[model samples]
Target: MIRIAQLSCGAEYSGIQRELERAAEIVGAKMISPEVSLEDVMDVEKRFGVSVPSGDLNLIMARATRLVENPDLADAVFVATCFRCAEGAIIRGEVRRYIHEHSRLPVLSYSFTERTTAETLLTRMEALVTTARMRGLLARERQTGLTAGIDSGSTTTKAVIMRDNQIIGRGWVPTTEVIKSAEEAFQQALQESGVKREEIQGIGVTGYGRFLVGKHFDAKLIQEEITVNSKGAVFLANAQKGPATVIDIGGMDNKAISVQDGVPGSFTMGGICAGASGRFLELTARRLGVNITDLGKLALRGSYKSVPMNSYCIVFGTQSLVNSLSKGARPEDVAMAACHSVAEQVFEQQLQEVEVKQPVIMVGGTSLIEGLPKAMEDLLGIEIIVPNHAQYIGAVGAALLVSGMLEV
Candidate 1:
């Protein structure tokens, strides 16, 4: 079992520590809290250059420093704090960064509310386990034989057929019935690739409906999108050999992942509201009387600064759009503002949790939006690469990883 060290404060008092352990147990991993001495706790303030009144917080710092000194104590690190505690939040980031920089172990950081449940942490734990146990598979540089990957996402379903490191076919469609949509996408890919179904050696499924679709298709791999999407993003961008960051702004959520050598070392996903998601942009395009595709081009023609927008809630974001148009703001400017609003929230909520490394690759359907990437570039002050077929990221990742199963 992968041993995941927990460096957290307030989880026990907040009554959510059991949820964390349950999440790790469900993913077939062990959650271990490193032993720290009273002496070690006392020296933490002097050694780490931080002072805290809370003994629990001090112990957290001591545990983090101990992990750095003894890297093999855990396969990965999970740093967390109560969402309501300001000091714990700050120290959480410091601990995460400290462990990440000092050791090669994968690190995941989260701020949990009292309501946080095992289901909420399941994906994170699964990603940690996958990162620790499947490094060789994730670091595999090439695809072999025939494989197909299907992404049953919240907004759309995508399918890809790959043969020996090259994509031969692709399919995309709006999500309706989960199994029906997945099958439709797979059939389209199968027909496009001109390959018989029986000849394909492996199949992979990912996204929100992965469990349902994976069971229906007998998928060789049923994985979460965090690891799968990062792999696909780097693969499509051809940045698998070095450090890279992937930002996927999806319909329901957003993910910011920091990767090294094609494997995800750290990642953050989800947001406070839909204001930071592609769905918000879809609403913006509807109000502007333009197709979603045209919103990007329209945004490029105007400046976001000309319009006042909210990035906190989707309802308020749409209200801002209505009020802007009422005030005679150009549809073009409104378009840019909407894109920037989503980008801004993503930058604040998700990007801040993980260290951003370059070359940054933006994937998912939202990446096709010219203004979204442009807005991210403006916020990040770096060029964002939207690779060919960026929209099929999950499907591509599924296809790529399942190819490894063919060798066995």
Candidate 2:
């Protein structure tokens, strides 16, 4: 069995350990002998006395080279390390150092969605080039030709392959290095589409990493969220008129795009504090012992009484969860508070004060909340709709931006 070691700063998150376990089980792999362990990485933080907020990501990152370089550690096939930080070079340099000085295991260092999103942007851009090749071979002359698009966000990298106007394959992976992650996702989607690389016709890229991706792929690249979001919106629009407000809760930000006649016309996005966005919901869900996807469902039958959960700051909101638990609050009420909190923070009072006439499109990963739609509907006096493939919207939109290529 292939063994993998997962080490993150104690300050980073235990969730990193949990995710490593889940990935291993899916691949029929095993954990390292010690499974999960931590080497004190708090020295740097102690030196600063406040969250590094900018340098070294975390203290643990700078020391990875020393920990993984142990000579006895040759058995690992995968080494997944999560570090919170500011620069990609800082993270990648340490991983390279460990590989050269310690074990030779194939390694991947994870940048939690907060700092930088996507696994490898360059890799994914290259992979989309491959996807474009496959599109041509699979259905060169079909209007529903195979095509690929990628959306790189602050939190995740999503890719999708569509064949002749119908959905055939899709992939949603955490965004790290936008390029590499994009390549992996595009390759995976093509594999599922059963088309080899030469069959792809074209590729499109959109979002935070789009400019960087554009520098890599020979295919077309776009940076407009409006175009990209709309590309995805049309697929999920509830009617010819569609939903009134599109709520996009992204990893680092939240955007409120108003839809007029099924197209985005104007928008508002929250500031860095996350007053209105997806991260708050994700953090809240984690603390509540429920997956974000289960959050909406959990809120379905909750009592109307709420704890008033709006806060622009994610850190303050976290503290709020702790306080609520101590006060003997039900998880459901807290979940409702979370839903209401994000909605209120994400949109203007104009958004809340207005008795939501249009169906709200809760886009992005937060829509996965199983109970949020209900809680939101209850508080805002309006219904919410989470699309089946809401998570892939950005990727689909990005791929759609790929210019039609000469079938080669």
C-alpha local distance difference test of each model? 0.92, 0.55
Compared with the true structure, what per-residue lDDT tens digits does model 2 show for residues 1-408? 444444343323534444445455544454453321233345534432333454434543434433454524423323223333334434443443345334433333333332322222222222222222232321221224667777777788777887765557777777788888777777778877787767777777776777776566555555445445644655555332533667667777655554444444334333447645677777777888988778777766464265655466777877887788789888888877777776666544224211133767777777777555565566667677777788877766555445334332
The segments of candidate 2 whose C-alpha lies over 4 angstroms from its true place after superposition are 1-144, 238-244, 301-304, 349-359, 403-408
Instruction: Report lDDT (Cα) of residue 161, candidate 2.
Output: 82
Tens-place lDDT per residue, model 1, 1-408, is: 899999888889889988999999999998899999889999987877997988888899999989999998999999988886889887887887788778889999999989999999988889889999898999987888899999999999999999989999888989999999999999999999999889889999999999999999999999999999999999999999979999999999989999999999888888889999999999999988999989999999989999999968999998999999999999999999999999999998888888888899999999998999999999999999999999998999999999997886
Off by over 4 Å in 1: none
lDDT of 2: 0.55
Supply the TM-score for candidate 2: 0.59
Residue 321, candidate 2: C-alpha displacement in angstroms: 1.0
